[model samples]
Target: MPITRRQFLAVAALTVSVREPRAYAADQEQAVFWRAAMPGRNANVLFGYARIDASLVPDIVSDGKRLIDETQRIIAAFPNVEMTAWDLPRRTLPPIWKSISRPVADELRAALAGLPDGVPIEELSGIEVSWLLMGEGQTPPNPYLGDVLARHSRSRGRPVAFLITEKEIREQFWLPRDPIVLNDTIDEPKIAFLLDVRRRVGPIGAHLEQLYRARRGEEIYRFTAEIANQGIPDPSTFIEEEKAGALAFDRLLGLLDSTDAPTAFVVLPIGILTGETGILPRLRARGCTVTPIV
Candidate 1:
């Protein structure tokens, strides 16, 4: 019998153990160790807008695939996902005003008038949201500020899990011919940033390898999600730019005006469980299959 995508996701969920490992002597000793950087220049940044809900997940295939499909949809919709890097400083910005400052209170008081029903606007006062919007298409040397762009990683308890392609490389793009000069400007590293995604269904067999193969030369793909305003873009724009950030944002933009889609992977999440088993049984009943991302 063949497996479906839902089944694969189920297996991924069962096999996946996202618990973070305890700090070892080496990890503790190396306080200054830098995290591994992702491959490629601009096509490595992952921009995900996921809403976390503590409520229990539902079992229907529609619901299970909804999570997977939506996440993937956001990843797909995101244009130039790779080149979209953020240069947030390691240290967070300091609070702008003291708690007792009247000016701050005054601003909050004025802004509180337009409150949503059942929500207290007063709760937001004095709370430094810290989140802010920095524009897109900014040139480098002025590395992106406000947001910290990082590779996607998932957690099981505390330990974070990263996706590794069974094939040597997951995806590929062209690089500059003059390798030495290119290497001089950017600090190139060996390892790449790992994004973590969990499985919602149960385990399966060799299908993961086949999905990996199918992904090797894929030019066009799709992702679906329930959340409407995921803040993602179309793929056509990304293909047109040939990846602006891949070269240099400034130079790349100069060559191409459209800052539409960011070229990158279309990450999605799916599930299929019922009863206490969560989404697992539903996946099996439907004969769905999943791919292993170990």
Candidate 2:
């Protein structure tokens, strides 16, 4: 059975009294307090996300083990509450002609040419190639590639949390980014220009429009092709990335709402929590208690 919000707060207050000042201490007294405080009502939820600076925290990119550790320490404050982590999934390419790189296209064309007119499309080794061959005109036969690409692109680089308990607890959730405009054809020069603009003025809407307008028609195509050849110069430049953050928060809220837990504590990077694209306000509007741990 789910516990009411008021009951959860009462338990939270009791747990706080037993929490130790030093978060990293190894004393067994803290464990005893947690065991005593365990109520049959519902487990609390704690969520964390980060945007780390490699220069300051040098080891941040190496699978985020250190960040996970720190998050575990923070979760220790809540007794008997199970913790989980969420992260973005890998990115994959679509089977659309536009998404196909020049080299891959050439290979597919050559492979098709080698086969007889009536040869089965099933002979193709890759799913993308088979779909493209059977597809009509320039578009793919179905949106399979588009769907896969969408899922991958939206989920790439999202954050997850892990429980920091002595006993092994294996539970996790993935927070996928919301779908956004994916212009794969932006070239390097334009990417460089955009990166420069972002560095100089940040992600101002007017500034981006002004810079984009300055480029010629041919330049835009060239830029688009370059981006298609490569990936988005920087994922942060796209408005969708920001929207993904909000989507992640929404997922967290949904998870909390579905359970009987009284309180859900979310930890996110200071930058993500305070910016124009931040979702902290939305979370608060939904009655979540927000705390910033910097």
- Which candidate leads the pack in lDDT? 2
Model 1 alpha-carbon miss at residue 98, Å: 6.7
lDDT of 2 by residue, 13-57 (tens): 111111111222221110000110122323232322221112322
Model 2, CA-based lDDT? 0.30
**TM-score of every candidate:** 0.18, 0.26
Clash count in backbone of candidate 2: 17
Candidate 1 C-alpha lDDT tens digits along 170-227: 1433221222232222210100000001011111112222222232111101111110
**Whole-model lDDT values for every prediction:** 0.21, 0.30
Residue 148 miss distance in model 2 (angstroms): 30
> Which candidate gets the maximum TM-score versus the true structure?
2
